[model samples]
Target: MSDTSGALVLFSGGQDSTVCLAWALSRFEHVETVGFDYGQKHAVELRARDEVRRNITARFPQWADRLGEDHMLEMRGFGAVAQSALTADRAIEMTEKGLPSTFVPGRNLVFFVYAAALADRRGLKTMIGGMCETDFSGYPDCRRDTLDAVQTALNLGMEQDFIIETPLMRLTKAETWGLAKSLGGEDLVDLVVRDSHTCYQGDREHFHDWGYGCETCPACELRAKGWNEWVAEGRPTLAA
Candidate 1:
């Protein structure tokens, strides 16, 4: 059974997941984080994960005590099995199957499954994910329906009720930036922009207002577009 007071956040050290982390910290008394290292092309995110956690704990004193242990799950097996642009050093493009080349089949499903397993061990009933549908690469696994189904299957198979919370599910990237501001103000937004890594091509040499990424990649383009839109909208803050 899931507890209402604590949560496990699926933190990827990217802008979106970092916002989700702050979101979890704002509401939950106790929050833990879990990240997967599936041999992603952008493994720099792995490094950013620790930095993001440290930054959050340091910058948000209110959440310092609430932030609990961080877990990094190694899934080299997943890397081998779920071959895609992310798991391989391939060109980032649209696949013949109509999905982004970076779309690793079942990646989110596997992530949630493993995250649930870790949560079970840690006695965490709630899971916080940053999966977005409004401004995403059309990954089937990022959809709410898919996550809901996975949640049901997880509960049935594990004989435990786990709540999957996707704060960014219905939000656009611009709205996500607004959310970061809402959750932790300018500090959080700056931290996300400075520390997060979201480029599929794993480019950290160039920097953008949104974050560090390759300007041409789909991920970077989406982030830049969102940042610009949010800026043009007077950078309005939203209620979390």
Candidate 2:
């Protein structure tokens, strides 16, 4: 049997997290997943998370046994405290603080803390996240430096060595698509396009080749741009 020492992915049911989930499943012997519900405006992604999980288990024979139990944490109060465009009904723009309205203060930090707590309990040593610097809003938590710092803190505080893996930390959105293809092939790519959710507005009514979304929000824009770039490049291999 594969051990829980493999990895735990911080899956948010978005394109990036879904790809990260697949990445973990491909590389790890036993991969578990964790998702958070901070009252996100686009709560539909939570549903998508379940769909994606079921599809991965059913479609990927090689990964069927490697996948393990899933975990969900409810922190709706966090959304109430850290109000942002993502957790609250506010316009997606820049605050005078120079951060995007989607910036849920300390959201990612809390995620690592919570995920690490769970990982410790689950006997997992590695945690994977889709946090990226490229093709992202200026969310400080998603940056590489922030994640590195958090990892150090988690180790120091917990007195246990835990590795936080950000597979898409440096990869652009377009490269992420290529990564999904590389890890799981065209079928995975198709699954991502059809099942993954990324619209910040939570609009699933509007469907685009990239997926269901408002098609104009920041999240949709990024996903569409990546798809367009991939298509233009003949959809060849994209390096990390």
Candidate 3:
């Protein structure tokens, strides 16, 4: 853990970002959270982000000491057009085809743009995210190549030294579960399952054999599959 390295996490109050948040907390001396509200279907997830931040602050009072100022930043406006199913007026059929309707155009680009500006202001060099290629439905932004390109662009555009870190980029959802369990406590991962929102339709209470995933949407199916595999392997599954 480098005491000089400051990290800004692109958090979304979902399972992936929650795990990434915990990971950033362990490595960076200064860990800050930046969330975006692009008018997604699950607007409640933004509320969940605030709840998770409150829970984190309550559990780790020392975290306040870690973050000097601008600890948590939330940005809204610049809403995504109805290009994808995520914000379209009609419901998106959940599938792995081309790209999901939930795919917000230039979402990562917008997020990193703001994060890089903040990093430059704070004299930070690292921006962390939970974009994973293994479990990505079809979003181009979640790919390793896309991240690499974006990193280069951010540095050149801002003329500031910035490194985008995707710790779970190559890991599967099951593998991400393992990482979260190891980095944060197992309870943190359990909190992710119970509290994080990933449903495309904003279904929070829907639960299956795999926790709170809606059990219907593609995101839920993937999450449920990963959790079931983790449980079947007896790999210290989430608490019930």
Spell out the clash pairs found in candidate 3: 85-101, 86-101, 86-102
Cα-lDDT of candidate 1: 0.90
What lDDT, from 0 to 1, does candidate 3 have?
0.74
Candidate 2, residues 1-240, lDDT tens digits: the string is 134348999998999999999988888888999999999989999999999999988878899999998999999998899999998779999899998899999999999999999999988999999999988978999999999899999999999789989989888888999999998888899889988898999887888888899987888999999999988888876543
Off by over 4 Å in 1: none
- Kindly list the per-residue Cα lDDT of model 1 for residues 1-240, writing each as its tens digit: 245589999998888889999999898889999999999978999999999999888998999999999999999898879898888878888889899888899999999999999999999999989999889987999999999999999999999989999989989999999999998999999999998888887788988778888899888999999999999999988789
Candidate 2: segments with Cα more than 4 A from true spot? 1-4
What is the alpha-carbon lDDT for the whole of candidate 2?
0.90
Clash list (residue pairs), candidate 1: none
Ranking by TM-score: 1, 2, 3
lDDT on C-alpha atoms for all candidate structures: 0.90, 0.90, 0.74
